[model samples]
Target chain A: MERMKMLEWVQALCFVVVDMELYLDTHPCDEEALAFYRDSVENYEKAKRKFEEMYGPLTAVKSMDCERWAWADVPLPWEGVR
Target chain B: MWTYERKLQYPVNITRPNPAMAKFIMSQYGGPDGEIAASMRYLSQRYSMDNKKVAGLLTDIGTEELAHMEMIAAIVRQLTKGCSAEELKESGLGEYYIDHTGAIWPQAAGGIPFNACEFQSKGDPLTDLFEDLAAEQKARTTYDNILRLVKDHEVADPIRFLRQREVVHFQRFGEGLRMYQEQLDSKNYYAFNPSFDK
Candidate 1:
């Protein structure tokens, strides 16, 4: 849980840098920056997916299974270390 | 599902600590229309979004807001790092020092606590999307305000990155609105639907 929290913090930072660049590429279409942003996003997505696979959903709507909508079982990070 | 990570995706090496500058930036952490509110607003709104593309956009942007929240926290952490009690007292961070003691807590510059009142999730797709659009601009304006007050390069770099995102989100919302309108029109938008009053 501690490890997850720490990586989540770092990923938060990386997410912004990569996302802002991607936003630029969507319109400006700078090939180099777009390429970099795409790579960064893929890396972040992999990290995020892996983290969620282990930790559960970060937001209520973003749960692993959208249909079942399971939010009760998972203990939030702020609630406990386990 | 979201989980917090331990390591920084990109290292933010704060060569020099500036607590005052950190305070100004701290507003975004808790201030109305700030990152905490932005993230909560969009993420919650995603639940009501029936359309896949719009939901995807909300997920992407809302997740991004989580990052902005972290960026603000990181700035606060780096600025307060290694500061002595006396330095903190002298730097006007004494108020924050008393409460958090170098820990990052979300609050506006005037010290207003974080509140959901800063944002909304109306459950109606158009209303929520428009709210998201407005929220993005509000954040962009707040970033502009932050840029005006901040001088440190380490802080400014990330602030600029966040500011640009607001623009991007606005653009996405604009696109989302058009798509949403098209979807509505499939039922014949010429009916003069009163539901559009929102």
Candidate 2:
């Protein structure tokens, strides 16, 4: 997949994960939602790893694989250079 | 405490430049009822919330507002991109251009810079939650005002999505308030400060 397209996929999955997290915070005992949330988190993690390997770090704290501090070098999302 | 996402919550691919529309829409970017204020209000108020669920709601919604802020910036940026000096001046953006020149600065359509005074984060949970409910409505009204002026489908589509989110957030905050009230004494809900009385 293209870099931008892959980035979008990762973003979409993360959105689902974040949304589910908000729901689960209110309904913490819902087993079904918890199952779905776990699945989405797994997918988001996989997609994030793939994008970071090809591109640069997504966040400064979790970019240990980066040889240098590439977080500051990459184009921001608003720059449309993904 | 937050993860980075490289795409907008809703996609914004504006194909035309409309500096005039950009100026109007810029109000939502940094206006009194803008997302920046929304985010700050909720995030700051959460520290005083005694209920975990209510605090979680504030944190999640507050985080979403940051994404909404980015979306508004994207819309303004795309609209102003490639606009010429003559077009900007003709569109009544010359005063803004003289200061920022197409760069995205947080300000209202009338050129009021963003100020924390636009929002309140009173330490009292009841007061803050009510303030939040009112803030969401104000933002919804602002989006409605923007929709009245924006003609482009690209611009209106995302604005509609944002307006819907405001309504949803209003409902959630309402639920949070009810939940907090239910935990209070049946005789007098306001008898004590749940946050401080413990």
Candidate 3:
């Protein structure tokens, strides 16, 4: 239950970061928007770290962070309801 | 230069095995207005785009469209996974089945194979942005068409999400066009390709 919650949090943060990235793309010099983007990205990174420690790395770069090879153990996206 | 991400951008856990629907949805996979073309068009056009920020927008959105393309494949795979031979044929997938044996292929519902001619990489920034805007609308329309026919709840969920993304992308491309225009000569009937002209 807790793992799902944390993963959901991480996913939500990812959504924010993705939107802010595209938003920043068009409005490049908007200082306030940039601040929001930075804040969301920082939180997204933190949430991702927590999720990786408990679950596994979301990408190849973070795969080594785990003590064991948990990279292949994680469920793929198409398997079941995520 | 793309890194492999094990998970999809959006979750697609469809439990139904409806090959008929899969056949139609496959259009969005390889059809003229599909995600594959949308991604390719933006990524290819960005090379000659004069504006740096808009070019970056193309990269980000094009990357996201790849995710959308994957989701479509996942949905089609899940839809066809447990379907029997008769079901596959009855659903009008017999021709596709003979060729791929339930495996995913990039083809339109009408069996037209994916072609690069579906999109263009015209070097002009405004021209490319306008094409992008039209592409997003066409994608949104395709999703809308899919939604009307989709009875399965699991399948409809992500389709709706993908449809909404088209509207958002159109808005962003419009903004990108405006930003590019703002940098050009204000009161002139100049007719020249800014990307190629010095």
Candidate 4:
């Protein structure tokens, strides 16, 4: 449950951080805000990599064990969490 | 930090409609403490958060509310799938059917449309975090009400999960409020307000 909770948090965090990154892209010179944006991106990347590694692939283009099909065994959102 | 990518975190399959569940879950979409109100409130309030951590907290929580909004919509879609006109009338979903005709909308059970009056965006970090704290409790209560009304264990599972999230968010926001307050004055910890000026 705690891992699932952390995964949910990281999923939501990645979305917000990506949004903030876009905001900083326009206003790039704000040193403090930029730092926050950079840190958030780094954290999101780390979390995403960790999640993909621990669990199966969540997104497309990520290579799985099966060579013929990458779309197999899609985990339903409510399956693992709830 | 924010982005504008349109992503569906979960795929909701609603081939058949259950009027009963639709009517019940609709309350969470537009209720006094529903997802729409929560999302609008926090997203708007983040502008006033001077501290980076507080702002980040708002962004994170607010974005989660958007996902919650999707989840509620998914639930509604699943319940309302294959619902007939007669079932809607019999299930007391006629008023909603009249307005949306099987389409999901963001409105309270009492028919009050979503409004900014549901929340505030005061430029003071202390005031904003306090409002957020209260908001989470209100949302948690709403989920509790849903849980009480919903008899289906399958549906209840997700609602229970969502309710637990509200509790966790409340804790995080409480920590955020305390952290923000501490940043203002490590000595004067008992003060109610944490703003720099007055």
Give lDDT tens digits, candidate 3, residues B1-198.
798666677667787678899999999999999999999999999899878989999999999999999989999999998788889999999999999897988998899999999999988887888899999999999999999999999999989989999999999999999888988887752477788886
TM match of model 2 to true structure: 0.88
Q: Which pairs of residues collide in model 3?
A: none
Alpha carbon deviation, residue B132, candidate 2 (Å): 1.2
TM-scores computed on chain B for all candidates:
0.88, 0.96, 0.97, 0.87
DockQ of each: 0.09, 0.35, 0.58, 0.07
TM-score of chain A of each: 0.56, 0.87, 0.88, 0.67
Alpha-carbon shift of residue A64 in model 1 (angstroms): 22
Per-residue alpha-carbon lDDT of model 1 for B8-79, expressed as tens digits?
433354658887887788888899878899989978988777777677778877877886787678777787
* Runs in model 4 lying further than 4 Å from the true structure: A1-82, B1-17, B186-198
Of the two candidates 2 and 3, the one with more favorable TM-score, higher being better, is: 3
Candidate 1: TM-score?
0.69
RMSD in order of candidates:
8.7, 2.5, 1.8, 8.5
Runs in model 3 with CA error above 4 Å? A1-6, B188-190
In model 4, state the lDDT of residue A41: 83
Instruction: Tell me the tens digit of each residue's lDDT in model 3 across A1-82.
Output: 6765676688678878988899999888999999999999999899888888777888877878767777778877665553
Report the lDDT of model 2 for residue B100: 92
Error of 3 at B59 (Å): 0.7
- Over the stretch B10-129, how does candidate 4's per-residue lDDT look in tens digits? 333343456777777777887788888888888887776777766867777788788788778778767776678888889888888888987878888767776778888877787778
Query: Which candidate number maximizes lDDT?
Result: 3
Candidate 1 segments whose C-alpha is farther than 4 A from its true place: A1-82, B3-11, B186-198
lDDT of each: 0.72, 0.86, 0.88, 0.71
| lDDT, candidate 2, B17-62, per-residue tens | 8999999888888899998889988898898888889999999999
Q: Largest DockQ belongs to which candidate?
A: 3
Q: Candidate 2: give the TM-score of chain A.
A: 0.87
